[model samples]
Target chain A: MTTDVLIIGSGGAGLSAALSAKEQGADVIVACKSLPNNAQTCMAQGGINASFDINEIDTHISDTLRSSHGLGSEQMTRTMCENSAIAIEWLASIGVPFSLDEKDNLAKRFMGGASQKRTYYAQDYTGLKILHTLYDNCLKNGVIFKNERLLLNLIVQDKTVQGATFLDITTGEIEAIYAKSVVIATGGYSTVYHGFTTNGIGSTGDGIASIIRAGGVASDLEFVQFHPTALKKSSILVSEAARGEGGYLVNSEGERFVNELAPRDEVARAITREINNGKGVFLDLRHLRREKLTELLPQEMKLCRLHEGIDMATELIPIKPAAHYTMGGIEVNDSLETRDIKGCFAVGECSNAHVHGANRLGGNSLLEIIALGRMAGINASKFEPKTTAKNQEQLLKDKHFISGVYNFTNQINFYEKREFLGKILYHNAGVIRNEIGLKGVLAAVRQMQKEFTFMGISDKSKDNNTNLVEFIEFGNTLEVVEMLLVGALHRTESRGAHYREDFNSENETFRSHSMFWKEDGVLCASFEEAK
Target chain B: MIKIKRFDRKKEPNSVTMEYPITEGLNLLALFYKLKSTLDPSLSFTGVCRSGVCGSCSVMVNGKPTLACSYTPKSGDLIEPLDYHPVKRDLIVDKTKALHTLNQAQTWIHKTNNIPRDTQNLHRIERQSNCILCSSCFASCPVMAVNSDFLGPFALTRALRYTTDSLELQPLDTLTAIQQNGVWDCTLCGECTAVCPQGIDPKMDIMNMRSKSVQNGFDDPTLANMSFGFDFTQGF
Candidate 1:
């Protein structure tokens, strides 16, 4: 079906962007690879902050800048900080009943970066509330939601986006959707790592891979944010609020090792260091306020206390660092429009809007998403329709490019590649990286990329074939992995989340974004000083 | 008392062990299911919807009352039947007494005619209706755990669905019956609401029932005293 705009990914970002586009009188269609709430955004347990009085903008902005370590864009950072309050206000306007303090004011508490109480939450499942609210409103406003449609390719012609081709996962039918504008909010590639705070589901980097193949440059691809604490065996995240509420990180010997309260990167790094040093760490939540724990963290606390047998009122919870956020993605400008592609916008975690810079502040990811999601949507609607005829030939050329992906005999399984890629990334370019490891990963990924080209596909005909889909996704993941390794290899210093164990010191040379593009199947990298 | 032995499943010399206080990740429901599936097929416990929504799995996992389905069984948990429920066998507890009390109290509104639902706002109450008949709220309530005859939070919350409806023909009659042993019994400590995994605000429903009771002049002396923060440090 034809539409004015088609938004890929039904997370908070995509739905919010669709709503914004609809608000501007654009007939928008939100398509998802899964159901609306299936995205990782709904799995988010902690809370999101907007710089209200409870969470002061100055402290929030300062914490964000501190995490970015002078690598974040001043403009994007400023815009995000300024717009956060409005984002929270908008969430409330749409009927997300945020939890309140005793005085009936918005509840706020310290988490991760910020020194002030700024996080607005609805119990522990803040994302679920926000996502359900946005989705319900979208339903009320008559925005069409197409579920289980995996975005396969973006149809681009003449340096502009035409539309996207998606495979209906349930029926296995491939449908080509034509739109004047397309917004990609397909989240990050964190699942590339074996161990992560993200769910086992949501690892398809469809938007990033499609955009990259369509010739969009991916910037800051190497910096991945690892959360300091998650449950021991399960990937379920133990919110940073655990520490913010006076929980302590204790070693195997039950001693507080690092500065109990420091930056997330520092704390996470310290935890990693402790683990590496044979001192397994645990979060001691035994002495925290019981009433507050029971009230605000009912679900998570119940899960921990009932299953773990260790009462948070008096026991140390086992913990470890797990991959959390990616500070790198499709490079977008202030308006969230890709630098080279018109009628194409990126928002949320998928776009490297440079708000978080090198490392993202804890609560800032959610805030930046809504703020920039709205911007991309509003800016996309303002675009005048192209006064050109429907280029059927160009459309056929785009179709051939997508068909080539389906037909390509590159029979690489993304799960296996994902496993291999994750090991390579974690082993080499993890919290601590060195020259030798970087070069090794670069050599390894390039070899995979090479072998990936000759991989044969038996089923070229695209019905709802997941095998073909997996094959294409592997190629895309490999393509992005090449950029990630290249970005990691090119940077000669430590900054924010990208710490080099060999370099060991934060270098002045690596103070901006590393942009990568593929030319003739060979990945090339360039740097742009932070604007 | 039940003799429950849990295994670590990790390859170690002492893998099999006894647990207390519901060791981490061992809800009675999951533990019982796991035991029955891989350990012994004949071992049975009652449960449905394994999500905390279904209250059927309300058992004491290591002494503290909680829903077994959602409760992860931890090591060293002293799993048992709820303090006040009839222990059937193993982890199963009979919920007939508690549920029967709710029914006899006429916990639901006696509808003379079906109120026409607003088709436009259909499923507005859908989220609230997502409650699985799990009595976790009943188990968590101190009053019900002590005085089983009290028209517990779960039943009262269900009653509010009918009594508070704008379309109900006899809201007062429904409200009066529920207020007798129902709304006033709640301590407002928010234990039931807090234990609810579905995010159903049972406390608010009980409070609404109290307000409706007060409006109809059928409010209990204890409720009026508690509302005004009276000296209730001594038992009524």
Candidate 2:
């Protein structure tokens, strides 16, 4: 079906865009890979960042810039900081139930590397509440949702993206959705760490990959931020609010290693160093007031109980740094539209709009979505009506893609390969990286990609075929992994999240964003000053 | 061994019951993943955030609705698709139709420019907002056996959430929408509350909604029908 705008995800970014575009009198359809509530946005436990004080916008911008470490553009950071209060206001209007402070104003809490209490929260389920609130508002405004449709390819004609091809999982139908504009908000690539990440099963960076393949530039892919505290066994995140609320990081010898309120990259590396030293890292929340801890960080308390089998409020919680957020995504202009493709925009974790550099600020992701998602939606809706007729041959080809997956001779199972990729990447290039480790990771990934040619799925059923869908996602992951390794290999400096053990320190010469794109279907990367 | 009920609409002999030796994992989802990736490649189930919060990997274990990612599994356990929704495969049920109630009931805040001074009001309705929409309540509710039109637990809870929200303006569409198939229809069996991993008592939320409905001038429709109970007038 044709629409004025077709959103490729239903997370906060896509839903925010949908609400904005619909309000602007544009027909909008949000194609969801999972249900709207199931998007990775719901998994965000930390509260969103917004400056309530009048002069604090400048401070918020500087905090974000400082977090970015050099690569974030001042103008892009300003757009987000300026719109922070407006976003918080809209959220409160839609019943976000942000916690309150002593004077009965919106409560703000400390996040790592922040100058003041600036994050607005709802207990600990901040992202889920915000996402549900935004979704409810979208429904109230009559935004259309098409669920369980995996984005396969964007339909581009003469260098303009006008629509996309979606694999409707329910009926095994290749549905072509035509629109004047499309927004890709399909989240990040942290799922490349698989068993060692806080991302969802669908957080595969497919949207970013599709945009890059469609001739859009992707920026700073190597700078994947490792969250300092995830449950060691399950990798479920323990929010930074724990440290913000006086929790401590204690090594096996009960010695405090680093400042708990350090920025994510610093804290993550410290914890990893502890782990590498044959000592276990633990988050000692036992020192905090039990009642206040339970009241303020309910999700963390519950997660520790369920996943780690311990009462974190009274005990030390074991932890390891896990791949959390990817700083890399489609490069967009001030308008939030892709530099190469008109009528195409990116938002949230999928778009690298120069708001983030190497490591992201703790609460900026939630703020970035509203600021950029609304802007992208408005711009996309204003694009003149255009049509790139559904590529019939490609449609038919993709329609048969699943069946081909089923028919392929069962040789090397890529599921095991996918798992292997995660572990190797985590050990070699996770919190710390160097030339030797990166080269080993690159060789392993290439070998896996070659073996993936013989990929096959035993699940032959046409309906709800997750096996086939995941295999395709694995291919998308392999492409991005290669790009990440190449980008990491070229950058010879320890800067922010992309720390190289060999280089060991940040250098002025390497203070540019890492850019990745495709030339004739081959992935390419370079360190260049972000434009 | 774990017993699983499998069905595929597009395949012949659509229903099958099979047992497989259990795989080692910390939770039921990990075991299911092991089953899918190694032993039996055709096994199908849905999981996203392999944590209880996302609400995607819920299924029936021994006739009880459970989130696979959170619940620990035991030997000889019987795994099946959720009770009410159409089974797409082994353990995945279509939640699309089940989730349509949110749209139908307009379970959203009737937002206004006037924001509340503080978040004190949130404590009252905090449980209602915790729903992850796993549809476990819908699957476990006895009411779905009789009426598919019932708005179900999550939607009703959301209706109550917005209708009673302090920031919401008067004349909420959620209140009116829940009158017919939304609030009054739930039997208040508490089965939804039992299976809820988030500890949200949807039954209490429904009861609160019923009271709010009375305040909003929505009469209990069941009182007019008058057919339930032991019927002492039967001429023995």
Candidate 3:
């Protein structure tokens, strides 16, 4: 299929980008790996950040920068903060049911790192509501949606990305999709934590891996935000909204350990420290009235009750910190165009425009998706169409290379290796990190990569072969994990989410973005100081 | 042990029942994942987030349409794909036709240049928009079994959401859109309401939409013909 713009995800960013591109008189198509509504955006229970009052834009920007520990780009931060109200208006224009205040205006609430109550919400299902609204708008605008098509490789010639090859999970066919511009919004790699992640199974960093395999660059991959209130054992998120709404995080001693409204890094570290000290952590919403709990935090209440059989209004919900958001991704400029790839753009969690820097604020993700995604779409639409035919031969060769690997003689168990990789990552690269642990993880990952190359898919059938998909996704996970470890090892300073116990605090020498690239089949890492 | 109804397009008979030992706290989706990873690498099912947020893992557990990610498995639970759609593989049904019903009903807010005021007092509208489109309600809907074109719960609920929005410019058009295979087609059997994971009462939404439709001067064809004077007997 050919289109003026091809979006690689169906979440908030991709859908928003499609809407913007279509409005720009460009034909758009969204290719998603799962159902349209199944992206990480749907799982965003908190609200979106936007200074609706306009006067508070400066405050919002400062709050974001402060939370990011001075690593965020000033230009990107200002763009997001200034355009937030317009993004909220665009959302409301498309009929997002934002919760209203007593005066019937868009309801604003306090998130952890925001100075003002500028986060617009629709109860607790804010992300889901916004996503559905955008998706509905896309349909109305005649944007084509192709689901269950997993992106395999980017078709790049010279320095421009002309098209992509996708493995149709439904038919098991490798097909080429050519486009004038390609937007990669495939979300984050927090699923590298595997069992202890708030991300969906599909958050394997596919776009980043494919781009890297095609010789693209990524930045700041070591900084992964660990949300403070995931349900213990299940890892389902208990939204930060619960805390913003006067809920408390208490230790086993029934004492409030830390300020619940602090930035995520502080709150998460507090919880982890408590748990490590033999003190259990719990989210106490029992003080809130049952009706209020049902009304304000419905999703969180429902997930806890359904998954853990714990009613929030009646009992203390067990809680822990889990891998939640990825602040590092494909390196993009202010317009969301990738640094190395000419015709390719990145948005949402998959692109590090450096707005989040080392730590993300509570509701800025949705804001980034709408504002940055729109910018990427508008900018990508203006790019002239390049010759895309030359990429077809390369795509075919890449397809054979991917499919041919299924027949390799394998001695390693795929599931065991994946679990091992997950453990290594979560233990070493999780909330706290150090040089020794990171180096250990790097060695373990290298050993796993050897086995990953020879891993075999038992089910070779072409149609909806999930085993094959898992195999491919595992490989992507391993590649991204290695980058994360190498980046973590190189940056010895403690900053935001990348807390290295060996190096206790932020150092002036390492105050820069960590960049990762591939050369001669070897992973390389370097730091680029903030420009 | 849990018994799952597995099907593969390439296999003979195309279906078989397999049993596997279940861990105590494992949900059905987790069990399916375990089976796919260890016992049979070909086993396929749809799931993401494993949380109830994303509705991709809807399946019939013991003939009840429930979210596999939320519902824990029993020793003898019989899992099957959702009905009212063609099964693509084991426990995976084609949800395209069912989801397309929303587009058919034009369940989207019309574009407008006017900035919306009066954003408050949208409690009802916000409640109806909580739908996740998980298709569990549609899977359990009895009315859909009889009429394939029936605008299922989520779609009708969405229509109600838009029609009730004070900012909606074409309120009458929104009401008219749900006149066929829509509000009137619903049996209001409460099956959809019972199966909804999000606690959205599509049955109640349908009833409310019917009232809104009547207010908009659109009535059910059967009810439109009824008179105040009732006959004592059918023979009369």
Q: What's the TM-score of each model vs. the native?
A: 0.69, 0.94, 0.94
**lDDT, candidate 2, at B12:** 77
True contacts kept of each: 0.09, 0.67, 0.66
Q: TM-score for model 2?
A: 0.94
Q: Encode model 2's per-residue lDDT on A1-531: one tens digit a residue.
A: 888899999888998899889889999999988788898888877789997666799899888888888988999999888888888997887778777777778878877778878888887678888888888888788888999999988877777887888888877778888888998999899998988898878888899878876787887888898888999988988877788778899999999999887667888888999998999999998877688887878778877877778887678899999998898888888889886888899999988988888779888999998878888888888988455555465566666775566788768888898888899899898998989999999999888877775877767767788887888898889988888899899999988789898998889888887888888978777778754
Higher-lDDT candidate of 1 and 2: 2
Is candidate 1 or 3 superior in TM-score?
Answer: 3
Using Cα atoms, each model's DockQ against the true complex is 0.06, 0.60, 0.61
Order the candidate numbers by lDDT, best to worst.
Answer: 3, 2, 1
* lDDT of candidate 3 over A1-531, digit per residue (tens): 788899999999999999999999999989999889998898887789988555699889888998888789999999998889899998888888888877777888777767688888887789989999888888788999999999898988888988889889899888888899999999999988887788888899999998888889999999999988898877888877798789999999999999998877889888888987899999999989799999888778878877777889999999888899999999998778888889899999999999999899888999999999898889878777557554678667867966786776656768777777777787678888888889998998898787775677888788888888888888898889999998998888999899988997999888799998889889888999986
Q: Give the CA lDDT, 0 to 100, for residue A223 in model 1.
A: 88
Specify the highest-lDDT model's number.
Answer: 3
lDDT of 2 at A333: 86
Which docking band does candidate 3 fall into?
medium
Least accurate 10 contiguous residues by lDDT in model 3 chain A: A385-394
Worst 10 residues of 1 chain A by lDDT: A458-467
Model 2 stretches with alpha carbons more than 4 Å out: A52-54, A244-256, A284-298, A311-316, A385-390, A400-403, B23-25, B111-120, B225-236
Residue A384 miss distance in model 3 (angstroms): 0.7
